[model samples]
Target chain A: MRGVVTLHADGLSKDFGERSALRDVSFEVSEGERVAVIGPNGAGKTTLLSLLAGLQRATAGTVSRPPEEIGWVPQQAALYRRLSIRENLRLFARLERVADPDAAVDRALELTGLADRAKDELSTLSGGNQQRVNIAIGLLADPPVLLLDEPSSSLDPRQRAVLWDFIDGLAAGGTAVIFATHEIDEAQRHADRILVLGDGELIFTGTAAELHAAGGDDDLVVAFVRVLEAQGH
Target chain B: MRWLLLKDLQILRRSPLLIGLLVVYPVVISLLIGFALSRGPDKPKIAFVNEVPELQQTINVGGDQIDIASYSDRLFERVDPVPAATREEALQMVEDGEVLGALIIPEDAGRKLQTAVALGGSAEKPTVEVLYDASGPLQGQLVESLVDSTLAEANVAIGERITEVSAGYLNILLDGGSFSLLGQDFDILGLAEAERILGRQAAQLPAGSTERAELERIRRFAELAVENLDFSDEILSSISNPIDVKETPVGSSGGTTLESFAVSASVVFSLMFVCVLLAAGMLALEREEHAYGRLVRGLVSRGKLLAEKVLLAALCALPVGLVMLVVVALLADLDWGRAPLWTVGVLATGLAFGALGVAIGAVAREVRAASLLAFGLSLPIAFLALVPAGTVADPLYEVIRVVSAAFPFKPSLLAMDAALNETGDMWPSVLHLLGLTAAYGVLARVALRRFG
Candidate 1:
């Protein structure tokens, strides 16, 4: 999305006991880049995002980025139901060692369009509002790399649009974003480049037009299915 | 009505654990405790003060009198005789938290036995004084039983001595002392003739018991006791119960029964509410919500995580506890034996219970498990952790007490109990609470490492 890459990964692999979650996946994200890690149910999308966010250590290979430069939203929204939105933001900012937590919290609340509901507890908000609060917490200290694993999995179509538009603004503002999604069309439409993983391996990584041409189809979704079939899925 | 009932069922299914906590827990806990108490008496460690050790002698009792040093030595090991040279020193030991309950043996106790045996039933009855620490209806019973048995054997020895005195004069009485008031041998004398004979003997009988029937009567009275020879019913009553058993619990309060109960309820309930709400409810919720993971990702250290939990728990729990104490103090003439020290104990209770809750959360990783584990542990603690310290002075209880002793509130509550009862050494309780709080904090830290 912008010049000069700020994050780099090479041949990242992870295994949980005997089961391999990710293997030989390499990627690079420049400032303002939006990279979508798209895969099916056990394609290691969440695991790859976790490794990128430094929420986990890779079993082999490496991913390089400043630890403080990354923010993560787990599959589950990491917001305490009892604490107010403002309190949650302030807590995260304080914990993240932000230079001025008060200012950071206020700014995050305003940016997320949750300034009106900042004093309200997360439990009292609508599902979409709660997701916004979760995103605000991740963006509170202004980390450059935002890793969200299936943030819209629970959102409806309208809520998903709201979330993607907000995420789009972050990428436009020069924050590199990596989000995992099972919806192929959404990923094809939103991301600058798609990383398609099949059976824990990165089978393909390219733009929707490049993927369509490679699979010999005009429809990107059909092309994605063709690529997975070719990868022995 | 049907819809309302259906709604209740839905709510119940939604939070089945909450319902179980409110209902099943109490019933199960009551059953466990009832079974344990019914099994047998939990013996206490009674501290006997050997104030006059030289004078405490083993009386020769029964046919096999090869002899033990004293009945004290033959007692259950729980009853330990602490060597206290003086009665004052023994009581001071109790106040200083050195010993539990104690029995004082006088210097002339052994001499009284010797005199009883030599004079046969005509000697002075030796007395024993018992001293008990703070509160223990149970330990008091144990001490009473011990003394009862010891004195019982002594009574047997005195009875044998009296029988020997009776036999010494039985040779003369064997002739049946046939009496005739009118200068004739009347074996079947009427009341008039018997009265006349008694009057004759009374005039001629030297100071006491010269005749055979008179000697027999003396022996009967001597079997009970001999020194105070006034044979009226009132005199016999005094002799029968010689040991007054004046159990003066060092600092007994001069308050209503309700007031005393309020203090105990204050300490125990304060401990329970703070610990359960913080550790089990809040901490487990944090873990379940993945906030702990989120916090760590935000560069929060492990120590800060525990500190935050403790701080939050205290913030929530201490005010309620302090308010409860203030209300009680205002309602009654609550004797804060050592006022500043009592306040310190209350504070320690809050801190320690907060740690206890954290430790529970560390062990139990989910909301249900945390609640069950914390409450399950706390209920037993409230019951077994006797506040007066010596309330359950059984040596056996002491062994398992190590578990409850590790809780800060246990020691803090004990100090409060002791101080209120007017029997305590403040440093011991405070130091114990501090040690346990640190231990609990360390345990929580270790537990969170694996649990997280």
Candidate 2:
């Protein structure tokens, strides 16, 4: 069961010059709810996440969550490669004005299960570990809403499982989770509510069973393709 | 802000190569500038062609003989003057680039000089022709300067000799020989004889006659006028020391001390390499790592982000600048006037350059490109800032002056120079620096927006 709404976007629209990236996208997320923004390439999933994370501004409409109350983890590691994981966390914690940066860094380390590798520089870490540090940076302030853009794009199966488990714990703790992903299986398995976007327009929004029923197909990838085709993408 | 500063410092501390470069850059620049100013230019080899051996002469001035040959010999101290057998040989040597320049004394020069000296007026002055290898312009100019200076000394010696010789002859004539007055030549012996004869005639005329009184008055007047005509000492004194010269400078200090020059050079080097390059490189590094957007999303404001980077650069640069000053002080006599003002100048310089570097890094996509841009910008700015006024042609120097002043380098240098040398007003530089800092700060913020 979903709790009270923690994030709300109403009539969000974004345009890049003459081309529209997102068109009147609307969504709502309640506490502890896991939402997946699944789309084809150039389908405005990242654009929507950026708008919600306050990394970019929407041309129209609004996001109810204040930017300070949001945690944005981009596709790239984006953390300082020369700095250690603890240093990176502490820096972001201080930047976000956390009450206690060291405590926040420690908690982020414990949450990501990267406390043992806290002293290792980002460059020396494996891709998965580096990505954990990236997520750790986003989790420093312990915000109410977390937005991840293709968080597991480059991870192996084992690393992907570990990242999902960590994110699952956060969502279970009432942190509203919104993620953009290309992997259909991960979205169907992990997300409680899935939003399908095709060519900058939201074509479907429901649980996996509802989407499967609507597409007249049991397979999630097949249903996703049918949804995109129906939207003329 | 502290976290932002610490992050950059921690990165720098890990990179030993970067730290080494930061320490080395300013020290090396200071030493190089110190050595360059302390020493004079190398002596250039020149060919000397004396067409007339007769002109190898000497003139007597106040009983001291000054040899014209010795003047050329004195030039050898500043240049390697090789003897060429003929004017053609000297020209060939110059064309072959065997020497920097050639000095040729024409065959008729000796005769012309003699005639001019003897006539005491209205004679064609002898000229010595110089043919320099213009291919190497700087060396050619040095050769010209060395030869010209020697010849000037020789001319002064000759002129004084001529005046002394003329005065000696005048005194001899005024004392006991025939002297000319109002275009009429008169022998003193004849004048004395006439005076004696007239006195006897006047005495034989009458004791109280009008003719006797008139002849006596005329003889007395002539005697007094002859005594006054022998004032040669006054004329000699007037001839020797004509037109006294006293130099007064328009600015505060007599001139910029060598120490002050080195201080300015060291500070400018630190600004370009330590402040500007480091700031640009760090910002570009973030862009390269793709962390710029993350920071933008997390930080309070983009303006604060840029300000931290600028402040980081300046704080890092301060110690490096001081190290450069210490090295300069060791190498030269450094006078750091008023500690507070010097510190302000250095800090302002760092801020101005740091802002500029941030602006550059914001536009550059990566660290290598930012470094290249910094290099391209710094060389010309350093050259323009350090190049002394009047070193080039008037029009080109004016252009450089205006262009350099428009940027922060010259003003930073001027401020530091004023503090070190205690010359010129530093307030103008301070104002200019503040204005530049604000302008570059705005530029960096705007570029970062596009970058983000």
Best by lDDT: 2
Per-residue lDDT tens digits for candidate 2, residues B257-372, read: 44456568667776768888888898888879978887777485778877888899878767777777767767877664466677777888888888888888887768987887
Displacement of residue A197 (Cα, Å) in model 1 is 2.3
Candidate 1, A120-197: lDDT as tens digits: 988898888888888888887788889888889889899999999999999999998899998888888789988999
Cα lDDT of model 2 by residue, A47-88, tens digit: 999889888988998999777889888999998888998999
Candidate 1 per-residue lDDT, tens place, B312-340, comes to 76666556666666677788666655566
Segments of candidate 2 deviating more than 4 angstroms: B1-248, B387-398
Residue A104 of candidate 1: its Cα lDDT?
95
DockQ of each: 0.39, 0.45
TM-score of each: 0.69, 0.68
TM-score of chain A of each: 0.96, 0.98
Docking class of 1: acceptable
Deviation (Å) of B226 in candidate 2: 38
Q: Give the Å error, residue A50, model 2.
A: 0.9
